[model samples]
Target: MNNIITIRFSALLILLVAALVTACKKGDNNALTPDLGTRVAGKYTYSELKTGGKTYPASDTNLKGTITLTRQTPTTVAIQLAIVHKATNEAFADDAAEDVDVVEAASGTIELHYNGDTIAKINGSKISIEGEDDAGTVFTLFATK
Candidate 1:
């Protein structure tokens, strides 16, 4: 019984150390410190938009817009984007984007929900988006903000 108790205590100690190490490694994420607004605030230029085999070009490589992001809590950032209408000819599941809600974590990855409808997943420092655009044209935004 004494031996079993000692073994259990050692196991618990090991587990506790492991947890502490993990927490320390992710300390920055838990800090809830958001990047300076201007550092992450800018328009990213998108190059290609594809649907089927054909690729649609952005009316403007520049996505004129405004985005406000706040670090709601550690590891979570709430972002709102006000995109200007391009008047580009494209159709989508009605709801014609008025705005988009995006949430980006410290992972530097952003998930965009357009007009409270479709969700687009974007990755990388260059901000490459892989998903259908609001106009139903396949869009891969290579722009960086």
Candidate 2:
């Protein structure tokens, strides 16, 4: 009985060590390349978010806001932005992104997604935000940092 218990303990220890070793991995010497840098979160000058190769609305061109993106985990990020509503004349800021998946684009473009749809993409110093409003209007914000 003592020998059987000792053998089981030894096997468990070896298995735990093996699993830990496999979980922790390292890339080459130059794993992190500064060429694809993170976009600085701050007040961004507004531009436009276009789909189907065309602008959505003419009135949304003059919007302004402050956006900040923070990393929550290795693969998850949080985005917060506050913008002034032109029609309502009120500041609308939303930090509703709970656990968004972030992936690095091949050409230094970072794409953000929730569920399965791509919500936004950060390309170089440009940030584009798009979402469907309650009224079914596609709200789009294209800004460059």
* Among all candidates shown, the one with the greatest TM-score: 2
* Alpha-carbon local distance difference test for all models: 0.49, 0.66
Candidate 1 matches the true fold with a TM-score of: 0.33
Backbone atom clashes (below 3 Å) for every candidate:
0, 0
Screening candidate 1 with a backbone cut-off below 3 angstroms (N, C-alpha, C), the clashing residue pairs are none
Query: Any runs in candidate 1 off by more than 4 Å, and if so which?
Result: 1-29, 32-40, 54-99, 104-109, 126-142
Instruction: Give Cα distance to truth, residue 49, candidate 2, Å.
Output: 4.8
Predicted candidate 2 versus true structure: per-residue lDDT over 37-118, tens digit per residue: 2333344545565655577442545455656666666677677766666666475446557577877767777888788878
- For residues 1-145, what per-residue lDDT tens digits would candidate 1 score against the true structure? 9999999999999999999988875355734754433234344444444456765555534343433444433323345434444465332222223234555656766665555543544555344444566566665434444
Candidate 1 global CA lDDT score = 0.49
Against the true structure, what is each candidate's TM-score? Answer: 0.33, 0.55
TM-score of 2: 0.55
- Compared with the true structure, the alpha-carbon lDDT of candidate 2 equals 0.66
What local lDDT score does residue 138 receive in model 1, on the 0 to 100 scale?
63
**Model 1 misses residue 94 by how many Å?**
16
